[model samples]
Target: MCPVCGQEVESIYHALFKCVGAKNVWELWEECPMVIGTENMDFSNLALKMLECGTPRDMELLIVVAWAIWCSRNLRVFEMVCQGADQVWNHAISMLFDFREAVKFCGLGPLACEVRWKKPQVGVFKINTDGATEVDGRWSSIGVVIRDSRGEVAATLCRVLPGCFSVDETEALAIEARIILVRELDLHQVIVELDSLLVVHQILAKDFNGGLGHIVHGISGFLEGFHS
Candidate 1:
């Protein structure tokens, strides 16, 4: 039932590192490992061995390449789109290049580091949301937490959504879910927190595109109720 190679494979490791499509990518890679993992090995074990076998940079490259493979597989499944192994490898290389550049540049600035979450005002509540897709891309899980000024949990939730969703779409779903939950509770004022800057920007501008955009519009509509 695997989409990448048209195989009835159930192994995550096989899908990402051993299948014909995935193998094409690794073979195209300049430093592909001869012994990445066996087809039947668990993904966690393979990942642990990879971590133990390489430098931090090596680990980062492995992760990025693996992510590219997943994206490629998802595109093939959900969109009926296929990118050659060369293209997938190039995409990952580009991402890794951008990431290294960012890290290098960010290391120069003290203010470029991550910031911790702060509590909202006394009268307002804060809702934080996050979403992550599973390895096979068939499921996405979202987590939402609502906290009051005293840092007490007002409400918390977790759900597994079925489908292959883009990262943006998944993040937008989390925001939408959070908005709906808060609205249902009739909370007057609430501050939302999410890590997806793209979604945040799109929402702030009231601009959206495709499936993610549709979800954002729904979220924007819900915002109108809170102004009263």
Candidate 2:
């Protein structure tokens, strides 16, 4: 039964991909392909379809979406917080993007998201980063890890920043650290992957803007070393 609404016994299908509540969760996007005839389909098939048909970026988005949907369901079942699919979707993207930025700081890029889904193979280096802060007698931290193609650990670091800071800044800092580490190792033709679109774009852009000069400068220097 729908514990929140007391209407009917909601199957996993209804709760995850088809219910009114689920629809509300993803309504912000132009549309989700899964909503069409989503009934009577298995979750594995749904994931397969998403992977078989979508671009690399789309595949990454789907991973976050599926994860968010699962998260919402767990929260609803245990905590009674019926998070709408739209909100869950947004949260999924935000979390994934921020995570990407953090991992990329260590010189891992799109491949990090891929390795997350596919698991890292032998001979790849993965770097994980974390940030911490003290709040009202407690410490909280957020961390992300990146692995190279062979799934080896290249870099892992955590910071206790001791104050309030947005996840974005931490992500940017992580990227900076990753790139610096990569330069120190002096590997030629290494693949650097990151999850944040903003950080990726900033790193790839040829010109440096003023506001994030330190980060941009660091990344630019790394690239110069790589090219030289």
Candidate 3:
């Protein structure tokens, strides 16, 4: 039986593909493909399936992220250390980032919403970003959504970083993360729509010497790449 879910027997494919985003949905549903193995396949077949999923870059990231997810599962089952999905995904991304120095290395659902959201202009994508700081002030969780002109969800990300940051800083981090996400998706001609008015002013004014100096500056650099 799976230590995490306890309802299903975990296999190699399950352990590797049931990534962080699907962690929450694991509790009640079998609908998440990432959380539930699509077939009773062995390792060779699993690799073959992954290769057919996305672009070459996506394949690399899948391998790296899968390794990190497997490690998190082991930690939870053996050491009894529990981590939120956001934290797990953030750690996996860091691992992928570091591996590139040694050797070049690297969810689902059209996360929909009921609330009314405005779509962007033709050929452009609008990305909305938000973040929440932990009550103890030790961690921050970020959420982002990207939608094309047609209002179709392009991509979404939620990650947790270990830090004690103010509202603006957390918001800035959220913006920074989408930079990585959009680039990986090869997205340009974008419009960033953030909830933090301060972050908006700072970015528009090109002012980066306040509390969010480091992250804000990096975000500015990333904006230069867009077709907007």
Please give the lDDT score at residue 54 for candidate 1: 65
| Residue 5 error, candidate 1, Å | 11
What TM-score does prediction 3 earn? 0.49
Model 2 residue 84 lDDT score: 49
List the candidate numbers ranked by TM-score, top first: 1, 3, 2
**Each prediction's whole-model lDDT (CA):** 0.76, 0.56, 0.67
Q: Which stretches of candidate 1 lie over 4 Å from their true place?
A: 1-70, 73-108
Per-residue lDDT tens digits for candidate 3, residues 1-228, read 777766666777666645333344233222222323446777676656656754565556656556656766776777565656544554544445445533421112333323367889998989998988643335668999999999999898898877645556778899999987999899888888776666777888888764566788999899889987
Of the candidates shown, which would achieve the greatest TM-score relative to the real structure? Answer: 1
Weakest 10 consecutive residues, lDDT, candidate 1? 30-39
Per-candidate TM-scores read: 0.58, 0.43, 0.49
For residue 196, give model 3's deviation from the true position in Å.
0.9
How do the residues 81-116 of candidate 2 rate in per-residue lDDT, one tens digit apiece? 555454466466667776776766557655555543
Q: Distance from true position, residue 149, model 1, in Å?
A: 1.0
Off by over 4 Å in 3: 1-116
Winner of 2 and 3 under lDDT: 3
